[model samples]
Target: MVSKHVKRNYRIVRYVLYKETLLNTREHVWSFLGAFCGIGLLATCQGVWQDERLTVLLIGSFGASSVLVFGAIQSPYAQPRNLIGGHVLSAVIGVACQQLLGADTWYAAAFAVALAIIGMQYSKTVHPPGGATALIAVIGGPQIVAMGWWYVLMPVLVGALVLLVVALVFNNLTADRAYPTSGRFTRIIRRRQQGGRGE
Candidate 1:
């Protein structure tokens, strides 16, 4: 009685709608607050110390990092090690590429991004935002180039650590939410659960 194509389309629509309803109000609130506080702190510090005309505190890649660190809290890429290692390594590679190949060149930008990806992958800290970090170093104008190696410490490392701390606080506020879904934190969570059950 029903057409196969119609049934297939209805199934696809239902699947899409189901996925959309997955994130509830509490998850949304936590994600928003976490990102806001993390980025806000970085921006406030940058504004206080750096010249108003220059964008020093927050890098473009960090925006992408916030999305994963806050929104997709469960993703492996959002883990603390990945977040820090990826950005730091990428920044180092990017600065090296810029210094060796000259900034503002397409070849340097491409090579930096490519090498960053390889480094992240081999290092087992594959965060997607690291690509942007590498590219920014290649063409972030004079200010970023000026910072050079210090860029790895300030914007990349500091920003990531702030986000990780925010995520730890915010995500753990709800009993159902867990941050740093692996490593030491995961073991601690398991111990707590076992202890609660008197195991």
Candidate 2:
């Protein structure tokens, strides 16, 4: 004879707990390894070049990128094109905003992120972390500002490529997991399987 309120609360709690449970422990482990190696390699490269330390290596948005690229492998936002194009385009827009409006101003930071979102949407590479990438350009201090357009190539493009490589290797190690779960790679795989089956 549980009260109706008590039963409703129990159902809600059960639903939340179920959603929070991990479906596969091995997938989580692979995701952890991919992010670790990817970011580690980028950081190591930056550390090796003492002069570029300030402008190269890690960016805060990369951490968010790792979560999507590794943990959420099936998400369209985590796909290779989105990860690379989103960050590169956002960085370019961010640098432009900083140069035009000056990095110190609050408006510049806000507008950079807003414009980045619009650009990513238009480009069909709408990654959530690109907003942070855009904001970092506006507020990343003198070192980043000095790098200018170079920032778009180095930390944005290079770092993303490193992550993608690591994800491809690590995520595919498991039979059930496949990196770049959609797009051209998926099509190629589907075609191969169809050919194998003689369909």
Give every collision pair in model 2: none
Please provide, for model 2 over 44-114, each residue's C-alpha lDDT reduced to its tens digit, 9 standing for 90 to 100: 88888777634476899999999999999899999988999999999999999999999889999999999
Q: Which run of 10 residues does model 2 get worst, by summed lDDT? A: 185-194
- For residue 68, what is the lDDT in candidate 1? 95
Candidate 1 lDDT tens digits, 53-74: 3348789998899999889989
Looking at model 1, residue 133 earns an lDDT score of: 95
* Structure candidate 1, residue pairs in collision: none
CA RMSD of all predictions: 3.0, 3.1
